[model samples]
Target: MAQTSASPDVATRALPATWTTNLHLSSDTGLLQEGLDALEGYRKKDPNKVVVRFRAIGNAPIMRQNFYKITVSNRFQAVIQFLRKELGWKAGEPLYTYINMAFSPAPDDTVSNLFKSFATDGHLIVNYSTTAAWG
Candidate 1:
């Protein structure tokens, strides 16, 4: 089959003016600004006063209750230290901690920030195990 070029009249025909006007109006609207404001509100929360809940997993020993609260501003290392002291594990003993049983966070990461990003039902569910659950 031979190729044919479009007629000049058809090629010059423009999109309906209503469609162009609608596109320009939508782009100029402040929807993006509104979305950014909402996101800023969500991320600007106060982590210092947030309380995160810790729960033991597997055969890991429990100190008092099934769950306990810690301030969000505290470093993840504090939780590790507390668990070690509570379990009475030797200095060389190993313990593992994770959030939602998904992944372990860095020791320097702030508890409140983690809680803010991952908490469910207003509680940050932390799982601790004596053996490594994930690499």
Candidate 2:
């Protein structure tokens, strides 16, 4: 088969009249931007802080205070660090952390996103064990 380019006139005629008129944004931005403002309003804003509840899995030691308020911007690594600090575990010590007793989140995951996705009763339940607790 031979290849042929579409003529500019054919292409221009193919589009609806509204397409040509709306191609350049109007001075009244609202004309082209209607309903977009509502989309912005509907977006869920992330909280500044997220509540994290720590639970011991299996033989892991229990914390005197199990609840903590962590900044939303912090990563899951910060949670591990906080756990080590609270439990008096050294940096090199083995500490396994899980979310909601189900899965382990990556250390780089933002706390806010985790909280938003997996929080229960406004708390991010984090289960910790010195040894590998769950598969």
Relative to the true structure, how large is the alpha-carbon lDDT of every model?
0.76, 0.86
Per-residue lDDT of 70 in model 1: 77
lDDT value, residue 87 of candidate 2: 96
Off by over 4 Å in 1: 1-47
Best candidate, lDDT: 2
lDDT of 1 at 105: 94
Off by over 4 Å in 2: 1-47
Best by TM-score: 2
| TM-scores of the candidates in the order shown | 0.59, 0.65
Model 1 Cα lDDT, one tens digit per residue, 11-127: 778667874656555474487798788899876645455545667778887767546567666888987887777778898787899999899999999887787789889877778
Error of 2 at 72 (Å): 0.6
TM-score of structure candidate 2: 0.65
Superposition-based RMSD of candidate 1 using all C-alpha atoms, in angstroms:
10.4
